[model samples]
Target chain A: MDRTEQERLITENRRKRELRYIATFVLMAVIFAVIVVLNINTGSVKISVPEIFRVIFLRQGDKVKYDIIWSIRLPRIAMAAILGGALSLSGFLLQTFFSNPITGPFILGISSGAKMCVALSLIYYIQRFGHSSSVIMILAAFVGALLSTGFVLLLSRKIRNMSILLVGGIMVSYICSAVTDFIVTFADDSNIVNLHGWSLGSFAGSTWTDFYTALAIIGVCAVVTFLAAKPISAFQLGENYAQSMGVNIRLFRVMLILLSSVLSATVTAYAGPISFVGIAVPHLVKRSLNTAKPIIVIPATFLGGAVFCMFCDLIARTAFSPTEMNISTVTSIFGAPVVIAMILKRNGGVKQ
Target chain B: MSEYVSASGLTVGYNGRPLIRDIALSIRRGEIVTLIGPNGSGKSTILKTLTRHLAAIGGTVTIDSEDLSGITYKELAKKMAVLLTDRTRPELMTCRDVVAMGRYPYTGSLGLLTEEDQKLISDAMVMVNVLELSDRDFQNLSDGQRQRVLLARAICQEPQVIVLDEPTSFLDIRYKIELFGILKKMAIERNTTVIMSLHEIDLAEKISDKILCVKGDHIEHFGTPEEIFSTGLIGTLYDISPKAFNPLLGSVEMPAPSGEPHTFVISACGSGIPVFRALQKAGKPFAAGILYENDVDWQVAFSLAAEVVTEKPFEEISDEAMRRARELIDACEEVILCPVPVGSVNARLRELINYARNAKPCREA
Candidate 1:
């Protein structure tokens, strides 16, 4: 090729790369806006889209509808975004940290531990306490998550391989789940009803208070993770490589686990431990985007996760209409196929 | 004078095995040092211990006379860059993004690259000749190109000391020479101390300012190539056979002693080279009766300079050719043969081997 032709080719390549970045950002923003709008409009009442917007932005609605729109639908949607973003971002961090495609937010057993705590609380006095039970449940979930993380850390110290630690986490999860099941079998009628709802997972009980509580936790975790994205990207190369680059690998692993646990447990306490969103959304983001770097993948996962949950919730509310299916069931319908395809694809083997 | 990196009485290991035991080594400024050894000889262990990837078990490794452990991770990053022979990771990253990571120590919260930093990165990519690949995905490159891209990333780190393990393992012969040339140039022109492990002995000898040969639990010898390349030392180091040198090749020949001879046919230009050397080493003698000039096999014959009866390309043989061939064949107890790709031009060679096989089977033939 001639010099001018070569230069033009180089310039054209650079322009295309720049356009891809811009296009991805624009698409994510458009999806985020659509998810927010769809989330606000869908609920038990068939409210008009413009009317819901007026309640949200213009303040023109009846007290009952306003209460339902502002207090119920808004918080539920906001919680979905917060928890979705949190779970998926946590999944991105875990995937990068483990350098494994199959690694998800719940792989470290913190989600299972949080689920166990919420199950324990639900099988005891959850209905008796009502709204106050949310606060107690969140604290218990946080403690459970921390305990699980501590156990994983201890087992990690014993094993040199990351895969071994992952197996240890899964084993701990099984043990905790067995104990929770045994506890549920012996509980009273009221406890069983509460446990069933929590286990199925829903944003049905979301309130403004719950949204703020989750937002505070998820927001702080997100900011910290955003700042940590570069180091986490370094981890994608491997722990030894990251350490050689002067990343404090020991401290970084602990920080990642702690932050991810807070995000997962907060969502569990507020929205009652949804499944599939954390494990499946990051893989979908990776498959679509074809990049594992946290700087790009983290934000993409956040927006992607929000859109995924919002769409799933839309399906859950509309498919059954008056009956109302659990959010997890709807998410799994979309999520399972992706999980299966990933397992079958080449180079899809996730690190332990 | 301050050494850029110095480890005094340093001991490092895992589970009390002491992989590197009480070793004292110092790297001065602007030198290309090479560590050469067999597998599991603790060459990598020593490098890791010095770089602070593995903590010293008993002694201190001081960079610029400061305790290495006391240096902050960011500060240590400014002092050194390391490239290891692990699989390259292809994240959602372009080659530029991967190289830009070297500037992470200098980047702020926004991770923005300044104009000067951009120039450094470009310069690094150019030095390693990966500037064209800057826009391509790192995973898409050939193994040689990928190694250079990674080297570009390390150069972008702009550290004083660069440590690499088997950097040329994936490279082709030309790229391997080019990489060593760049490394040698960096050591001299930029005053960077470069330490790397290499299996390419000839390349290492040509480029390295000093060589550290590790074998069997410790540093066997550490010196200049000329200081360490004596025949006795090399023979002992590699456990080579043949107590004395070969007068023909003027190099050590490690070959198995005599075994029963088997007639063989080799037609390759370079393929016959190994068999000829093997025959010489095992005390088996052979004679060549026919050859043509300007062929690859002819080059091997010329290098070994073996005696052979020759004719011009595509020329008909006379009574003299038949007489010489018969004399050489009669001297040998049996005939070993070879075929050259001389088409119908040398159809007589194929006929000769066929004739011998048909008439074969004498007592030690």
Candidate 2:
């Protein structure tokens, strides 16, 4: 009630908050380490942990084991982590940009649009030159993502309702998917199989080059988002308040769109489009951290996405021993429930 | 110093067309200015334009004598703050966090609160009596409490001028009074110019140094509340019937119970207010009388009573007045007497009360 008593209580609350945040970050780090170790160790044709470590650290092991780690398993694991982080961080940025918790690259059809463009480019390049480069795929995905984002942005300007905007996004997504289907149906047989695996969204047969490309794009975007924490915090109040707080709204908006698009595009180019992580991981990170301040949530969201996707990738690889489930299938199983819970939690607060 | 905030030839409206044009205003530092007008008269549009929430279709607003369009948003933010009617429901933010956001112009890249910023926030919460609410989620607060918390946020901004649009609309009496008090203190103590639109003309008359009357397609009047209220401008500005608002008492009443007089009320010194109300609600045409002009009862009585037999304030009861009061009492079918102190200056009511007590047609209620 009085000044002295209230200050003491706030101080205690701050102390408790500090401990809680520390515990959460430490827990996330621990989970991330555990999932990474388990992913590398528990794959098919298992190499023992000591042999895996010797192969990873000492650069010496059985030739087959070495090939699996260097050429197959290691790159696959790295792609999963890097692309997963990219997806969730993009989701976080979109959620902030729209000021809606449920918005993400996947739900907004950004990934689907990117997949369509990547498919088109792959078919054109492979049919003409007998080859397709990662650079071209990333560029095509980026262009497709911008197209979808542009549609959503124009639609959002006309409609303030999130559900209507989501419907528009889905419609745009459907058109792109239909066109991709037409391409797949007409493509020559060899490229058709490659398109099937990429469209279904997978982390298989990933190479070191794909891993490095995803790492560079995601890392830069994530850091920029973190640096924008102050404006993002103000933005949570609404756009007017964010502008009133000295944020250059026009520039800030363009940056958010560009960065989020690049991150999601990188994910799509590397792993097709993983579902739900873009919508779910940011929610989980903010929930665990108990704060949505971008300075903290952005990094935690990246780590959370890494841990979640790695775990899902493990199940996708080992669920049937050799018959791998699609990575999107695995993510939807775990991440869709979180999304459903978010919807229920939101609707539960409204009275009939 | 030049006026803290002023607009000249300002035209404000939606979608780039002017709703009210050629508006000019000048508010001094440490002054509280209020805008009062009829609904749909564009008071809010004017406030919005002044706050830069809506761009002015034409003309310019000068803040601290600087051309508004020339000022950067960051510089303007350091000099002014605005609170509009749009309810901002920021999820997962505590009241303190909402208030702390007022330090945006001063905070670093991460928006972390410095020690001095925290002190300003705490002091603002104390002023608004929301110290205990600091840790509570902002969305969970009741409307009145939420209003106070927002006032605290505006205070934390430490701007030279604060513009609020309809600041008292949803608040109860206590919150309204407290908010006005806080606004007044800020204007005087911090030398912050306060500009806001209020629906309460009565409160506006009491609180504002300058009142802007908006009506029709133009800025109607801008002057002291004395000049505005004494001219009985509010009723005309609002298109209200003459009897609906009593400018002298700063109160409102139903259109005087019209028709032939059927009941007489004997009262003076503010006691007849309830009796007049009851008679008005019952739809009984009443003639209420025998009072000094200065009595608080006269305003409502003058509004509701079919005929008010009156005497001048502080004047002795004349024979003519007593005769008029007795005649009205006799003509009435029923008499209602209000229990008022029998004073010497206007003891004429005693004769009327005795007559009612002896032969009152109503049940002496």
Candidate 3:
């Protein structure tokens, strides 16, 4: 074809890509809004949509509805959205680090590592001081996350095969969970009550303080990750190409590991090892966007994760009415299938 | 012209030990320099060191009078682009997206392509004849198409120098020619320096302005293709029988049947090559006669025939050569006559054919 025609075709493709991005983002935003409203309106108190809005925006509803909106449901919604975005972004970074789509923070045992550390610290601090601070939990989780991430990195060095690395990560996850379960089993009765609720993964009891802390951590990390879109995009081509493109591979790799660790650690500290959101959200978002360009995928993934988790959280809260399911249960139900389907599709594509 | 890319006393290897040491190179802008060597001969190690994928073990490389060690990777990227042999299986990326990645060094912080960047990307795709595949997914392209797209990516970087490691490894003959043709055009038109490693010595001889023959722990020979190809250095470089490779035609032939001649072939004008090969494959050693040194048949016969009686170019068969041919026909068990025109220059071949017919059982090939 002629040059003009070629240019026209390229321009048309770009336009189509942009349209897809805009449409996907719009759809995600609409879904996010719907989930937010649903989460706020569908709790045990049975607040109406208008009453929920009044309590949230106008601040002039029944005292009980206002308290529920401000004190409980709103904080829970914010925590779920922020932590969910954090978890998914963490997964995306890990996928980029390993150059494998199926590997994520959860699959790599990072969340469980954080869970183990948080469990250890919760038992120690609550036993010694009667109550533990969120800061201590986050710090402990960060240490645990880094420890697990460090182990995974070492394994990755020794094992270049991605499947084996994933298997190794799963083994690490199992070890960390076994240790956490051993500790939880022997902890005091009161501590068990607190740890049991947190260990199973729930957005319940998320205070405004927890929401603000997660927002601060994840917001900073998300912006830093967004700023790093160029390198991450280059990295999708793999290390050699990324280096040729001027990315300092060693430094960029360290940054990816550290950033992902922090993000997953924060999520684990808040919501106790939510499963599959990391692996599933980024994959689904990239599929929907029809491009893996990090400049678009990063934000779209964050929003997609928010929508997915908020929807999952809504179910976790109201699925059995008075008896809430764990957030992990809800996420696994929706997200695990996506992961399995992705693996099957990948295998099919490879066979073809 | 002053050398644009020069390396001296360069020692390169993995870890801290040396694989190839004390290598020296001087290449001007627009020169296509190729490293030709056998497998595991440190060609890739040298290329990787030059591209800064591996740190130089010792010594230095300078580009445009600036020390390579002094240049940061980002600065180096602006000057030198490389196409590695690694297969990049980027997910969900279209051909255009892959080519656009060449703009990494030039694009802004967020890597949004400007109109000029897009234009350059498309122009690169056009240069490599992959523009038509602009919308296709990169992973779905054939190996040849992928190589071309990757070359376009390197070209789109618009670097002063391009380094590629075995860029033609997976390409078939047609794509190989096309790839080198594009490289040559890029070098001549844009004055971009091309440095790469190639396994095909024939193509390397034809395309490279400078051929760096790598072997052992150092550069065995580094000079123009004429200097390298004429010295019979390729045979020793690849550890093959010197007779197996024809430096003139840049072709390799299997070793000639290793025995005394059992068949005498009477042929001229390029007709004897297939008969010689068939006899060689059947393990029947043969002797060929009355070929001018300049004849195309002589190229193959010189490499594959057990013995060839030759006359000088532009000369008819001498009496002495004909005597030797008759003696050979007398010794052979059979005579195979390949079709040849009875031209005035080679009329003497007809006499040998007739003589062979009488002395031994003759068969037409």
| Candidate 2 residue lDDT tens string, B1-365 | 56778899999999987899999999999999999999889988898888777888999999999988788888888888877777777767788888888898998878888889989999999999998898888878988788788778888989899988898977999888899899989987899999999988889988999999999688779999999988767778998887787777778788766788899987777788988898899998989888778888888888899998888888888889888877887788888767778778767667668877676575444
Candidate 1: segments with Cα more than 4 A from true spot:
A1-14, A121-135, A150-171, A287-290, A347-352, B242-365
Residue pairs in collision within model 3: none
lDDT of 1 at A342: 64
After superposing candidate 3 on the true structure, give the runs of residues whose Cα lies further than 4 Å from its correct spot. Answer: B314-319, B339-350
Query: What does candidate 2 score in Cα RMSD to the true structure?
Result: 2.2
Cα distance off (Å), candidate 3, residue B200: 0.7
Clashing pairs in 1: A291-B92, A292-B92, B269-B297
lDDT of 1 by residue, A38-98 (tens): 7666657767777877887888787888888787787778778778888888777666655
The most accurate candidate by TM-score is 3
Tens digits of per-residue lDDT, candidate 3, A1-352, equal: 7989878877888898899899999999999998999888896778889888787788897988888889988998988899999999999999999999998899999999999999999999989998899999999999999999999989988997888999999999999999998998899999998999998999889899888888888999999999999999999998998888889888999899989999999999999999999999999999999999999999989998888999999998898988899999999999999999999999998973
Per-residue lDDT tens digits of candidate 3, residues B80-148?
889888988999999989999999999899999898998899889988889999999999999889989
Assess every candidate by TM-score.
Answer: 0.82, 0.95, 0.97
**Roughly what TM-score does model 2 have, to 2 decimal places?**
0.95
Cα lDDT for residue B101, candidate 1: 74
RMSD of 3: 1.6
* Model 3 TM-score (2 dp): 0.97
CAPRI docking class of candidate 1:
acceptable
